[model samples]
Target: MPVSSENKNGPYKPQPIKKVSTTTVVNPGFFAYTNLTGCQPYYCAEQVHLINNITVTALTIIIRVQKTSAATYHGVANNFWTGYINSNHTDNGSQIIYTFVLDPTQTVVASTTWYVEAQMDLYGTSQVTSADTYTVSVTGGGITNSYSGHF
Candidate 1:
């Protein structure tokens, strides 16, 4: 039997359109403590606020210390000394907001031992006799924040 070309095409049905979504990481909100003083044993203590909606695997904290130009202190480093936060901690994604102190005298507090280390010795040697200033910057979750302090 021979087939005819006419009426050879089959009926077509309309297909539903599918939607596509793209996921991207969002930056978190950061609030720094502007007023910090190193009067307590040559170490300044302050808390930083972070509002995150996504997981932050690695966070970097940088602290830079420098003696003020008007400072007449000796036996201390007059230049900028930088410190970093080198640790393995992951911030889970959530709607909850948390704050942490930059320097803590005790490692464990209320069973939660999370704190940043910005010791005066890390900045320089001896005591900070005269006025000194420090700048701390934190970077994580695609955002960066910074603040200044004095002693």
Candidate 2:
């Protein structure tokens, strides 16, 4: 038997992959404060914008600390939601977002602990300024938040 022209077109071909990588991180909200004088004390009393859909108590805040610029985050946790930050996930503004399974009934309190780190020397000119503004930041729920304090 003779074959038709359209039937001999070989196997079907799939389309190409189209994935665009993002390189920019934008900040929607920010938190700022001042630490008068202390020695690596656990930083606390920081406030974050409470989102409607997100349950505050169920979600844990992944924190990153920086002295001068928004880079080089290496600090220890000193209070609730405590954790250390390191050089990981370079593309996500040096901060990592860790999603957690939380109870819906859990109610999150405002002005909770933000960050806790050993008192860093502020006089050093290498990577710190006179005030030593330490920035603690997190990104989630389509919102970017940061807390700055001078210790």
Best by TM-score: 1
True lDDT of residue 145, candidate 1:
46
- What shift in Å separates residue 6 of candidate 1 from its native position after superposition? 84
Candidate 2: residue 79 lDDT (0-100):
32
Clashing pairs in 1: none
TM-score versus the correct structure, for each prediction:
0.29, 0.29
Local error of candidate 2 at residue 91 (angstroms): 23
lDDT of 1: 0.28
Give residue 103's lDDT in candidate 1 (0 to 100): 28
Q: What clash pairs does model 2 have?
A: 40-118, 40-119, 78-116
TM-score for candidate 1, residues paired by index: 0.29
